[model samples]
Target: MSTIFRASRPAFRARTFFQQNASKTTRRFQSTESTTANAAPESWMQRFWKSEKGPKTVHFWAPMMKWGLVLVGVSDFARPAESLSLTQNAALTTTGIIWTRWCLIIKPKNYLLAAVNFFLGCVGVIQCSRIFMHHQAQKKLAEEVSEAKEAVKEAKDAIKHKSS
Candidate 1:
């Protein structure tokens, strides 16, 4: 069979394979070059617009969206410190610190993410400190009230002794 002769001749098959595919490969390689060559140089903004981490991709948008957390924390500024929860703030601070380090180590390095997380940590710490101070003040007031009551009781007993 001619098929057997063809199998025996690998050079003929290889030559035909290359000839058939060469046009397709060349077209792919050169498809966009000519149009781009006549274009003016791109500005930094333009370049960023089309870059891998641009607004079109999730990488940029995720960080932008994450700013909401910081805004929420900031909004709490009008709230009384006594209402703040230490556990919640501590969690935010811990998460912020851990991910801030992770952001720097990731491929391409997300500075926006790092900044947001870092600030998240800051907000958490400030809230925790406020709660701690409030608790401390309340505890001290409680101790003072206890001492005052004890002194009043002792003075009443002394009055009874004098009357007897």
Candidate 2:
């Protein structure tokens, strides 16, 4: 009976450890800091709560824009006539201008490299209207979300005032 109890105790501890550590989602979601003794923290829901500047959003946007420019440049280089049109060229130029302005604003030490990338990124943004459009949509969505939240808080305050 004593030997059987000892074997069961180790198995129970191993099972508990495995259950605590294993998750199929993001590592941030599985972190110990986010959890409690009674229940796991709602890490997934916490993603929506933007208390401050988030690194994930910034990281995602920069890389996505950079890669988008790369794809546009490659496509434009390969087949300018088919892959890009007059409107696309204009867009690319506009994008380049924006990027150059940003680079100047940041004042990177590697000015030459930054300038080249800025121009290249502009071309890509112009070439791929889809990417640009998507970015615009996302920007709009974020703005709308902020506005809506503010409106809701204002409405709540108005209700409280009336009730008082």
User: What's the true lDDT of residue 150 in model 2?
Assistant: 100
Best candidate according to TM-score? 1
51-132 per-residue lDDT for model 1 (tens digits): 8789898879988887888788888767888888778888888988998999999988888889989998888788778888
- Per-prediction count of colliding residue pairs? 0, 4
| Per-prediction TM-score | 0.75, 0.30
Off by over 4 Å in 2: 1-60, 80-83, 106-164
Residue 118, model 2: Cα distance from true site in angstroms? 1.7
How far is 114's C-alpha from truth in model 1 (Å)? 0.4
The TM-score measured for candidate 2 stands at: 0.30
Q: Lowest-scoring 10 consecutive residues by lDDT in candidate 1?
A: 10-19
Residue 84 error for model 1, in Å? Answer: 1.2
